[model samples]
Target: MTPIARTRARAVETLSLDATATRNALSSALVSGLADALTDCGKDPEVRAVVLTHTGTTFCAGADLRDPPAPEALVDLLRQIIELPKPVIARVTGHVRAGGLGLLAACDLAAASREATFAFTEVRIGVAPAVISLCVVPRTDPRALARYYLTGERLDPAEAVRLGLLTTTAEDVDEALSPILDGLRRSSPQALAETKRLLTAKVLETFDRDAADLTALSARLFSSAQAREGMTAFLERRDAAWVV
Candidate 1:
C-alpha cells in the first residue's frame, strides 16, 4: 500500500517503484500508479522527461504472483508510456523479468548497469508474453527474442544491449545516462513530442490493433489449470509438474 511511484524536479520525474515487499512486483498499485504518473508527466508543462526506477535490488520481479496483475492494467500502462508526449527513460539497476521487460521496452531510452540480469520468463509459468509482446517485440532482436522468449533463459546486460533491449550498459548507470538526459533537456518540449510521435507511430498502431487479442490470450492462459499449477509451484519454490 506504500506509494508505488513519485515524480521529482529538474523537469525530470523519477517514478520509483517502492514495492520492496514483493521484490517490486507489478501489483495493481504499481501498474495503476505508473499509468497515472505518466499521464501527469504528459500534462505537466514543467516535466520534460520521466525516469522509471525501483528501490529494491530487483528492478521488477514481474507480476505479483499471489495477486497477479490484470492484463488490461499492464496493457494500459505500457500504452500510456509509449504514447506519452514526454520522453520516458528506464534506469535499470537490477533484475528484470516477464512483464518487467515490457516496461523496459516501452521506455524511449534505457540505461542499465553491466551486472543487471533480464529474462522473458512467462513460458516457464505456463503462460505467454502476450500483453507484453506489443512493446517487447519491437525492441528485442528477432533471433535472440525467438530463443529467450521461449526458453525463459536469463541474459546479462551486455547481451541485452546487443539484443536491443537496453540503450546503454555501463559499470555506472548514472555515468551512462547523464549525457542522454542532458541532450534531452536541451530539446524543446514541442520537438520532443513531435519526434516521439514520429518514432512511436507504428508502435501505437500495433498496440491499438493487437492489444485486445493479446490481453485476451494472456487472461486465458493465466486462468488455465496448468498455469495455476505452475504459479503454485513457483511460489512454493518447486518445479511445476510439466517441468522435466
Candidate 2:
C-alpha cells in the first residue's frame, strides 16, 4: 500500500499517513508521497481544506533513521504544508515525536485526541530540532519550547495546546474537528487562501531566513559520531554511551 492515502468529503480532503509499519516515520518515500499528495490537493479546486492524519498508534516517530529523507526534502515538505493555499489541519490521535512535531507546527490548525502525546526527541538523539524550528519557534511559546526541546519531556495534548503546538484537544478529535471543517467548507476559497497567507507570512519568512542554515545543521549533526551512536543505541534498544 502507498504511504499516503487520500480521501475527500464535501470540500475537504484528507491525507492519511498509512505507513503503519514505520509509525509513519518520515522516510524519503513517505516524504515524497506526502509532498506529491499535497500538490494534488492544492491544484484541486474542490479541496478547500486538507486534513493530515495517521493510521497507527504513533502519528509519526520522526525521521526514518534507516531510510531518512534528505534534510532539504524534509524542509521542503514542511514549507509546502505552510505555503499550501488551502488551510492544512492536523488530526492526530497518537504519539508524535522528534521531527513529527515539525509537521504539527507547520499546520494551520491542529486538533489531537486527549490520548495524544508529543515530544521534541531530537536532543536525546544527539541532534537538534533544526529545520522544524522554522515553523515551531514562530508558533509556540519560547519558554515551553526550551524545556521540551532540551529535555525531550513528554507533553500531553492539553499542554501541547497551551504551548501553542496544538490548536485544540478533545476526547474525540473528529468531533472537535467537525465544526472547524464545516466552517472551512462554507468559507470562500479565495478568502481562505488569503487568510492562510496572512497567518503564515511569519512562518514563511522564517523558512526563507533560516531554512538553509538549519538544513545544514541537521545534515551535519546527523552525520556526527554522537548521532551515529545515539541512532545505533536506539536501534539496538539500549542507551547511548552519553546517557547518564
Candidate 3:
C-alpha cells in the first residue's frame, strides 16, 4: 500500500499517510509523493491551503527504518515542506513521534486531537534527530525542546500545546480542523500566500546564520554510540541505558 494519500476539498488539499500498518512510516515513496503533492498544490491556483493528516489512530510513527530514504533525500523532503508557499496545517491525532513530529512541525500551523501525544524519540532509537530537528527546532520553544530532545520524553496534548508544538487541541480531528478551515476560507488567497512567504523568509533569515552551530551539534549527537544504542533499544522495545 502507498504510504501517502492525497485528496482535495474546496481550496484545501488534504494529504493522508496511508501506511497504517507500520504506523505510516515515512518511506521514500511517501516523501516523494508528498513532495509531488506540494508541487502540484503550488501550481494549482485552486488550492489555497493544505491539510496534512494521517488515517487510523496514529498520526505518524516516523521513518520506516526497514526502508528508509537517504539522509539527504529526507532532508530535502523536509525542506520542500518548509518552503511550500501555501499555508499547511497538520491535523494530528494519536502519537506524533520522531520524524512524525518533524512533519507536523514543518506545517505552517498544527492542530491536534486531545488524545494526541508527541515526542522526539530519536535519541532512544540510536540516532540523532537530524532532519526532524530542523523542522522542530524552529517551531518549538527552546526550553521545551531542551527537555524533550535531551530526555527523549513524550508530551501529552496539553503539554504539547503549551510547548508551542500544537496550535490548538480539539475534542476530535474534525472538531479541531473546522475553525482552521473556516479561517482559511475567510482569508484572501493572495494575502495568505504573501503572508506565508514573508513568515518563511523571516524564519529562514534567523536560522541561516545559525546553520553552522546546528550542523556541529547534529554531527556530535549523531556520531555518538549513545544515539545508536538508544535508537536500537527503542525499536527493539527495550529500555535505553545511555548515560549523559
Highest TM-score against the true fold, candidate: 2
Point out the worst 10-residue segment of candidate 2 by lDDT: 1-10
On residues 55-141, what C-alpha lDDT tens digit does candidate 3 reach at each position? 988898887767765566666666677777778999987788888887887788899888888888776666667766676777778
Of 1 and 3, the candidate ahead on TM-score is 1
Clashing pairs in 2: none
Off by over 4 Å in 2: none
Error of 3 at 57 (Å): 1.8
Model 2 local distance difference test score: 0.94
Candidate 3 segments whose C-alpha is farther than 4 A from its true place: 206-228, 241-244
TM-score of each: 0.97, 0.99, 0.88
- TM-score pick, better of 1 and 2: 2
What lDDT tens digits, residue by residue, belong to model 2 across residues 174-201? Answer: 9999999999988999999999999999
Model 1, position 235, has a per-residue lDDT of 91
Which has the better lDDT: candidate 1, or candidate 3?
1
Give the Cα-based TM-score of candidate 1 against the true structure: 0.97
Model 2, TM vs. native: 0.99
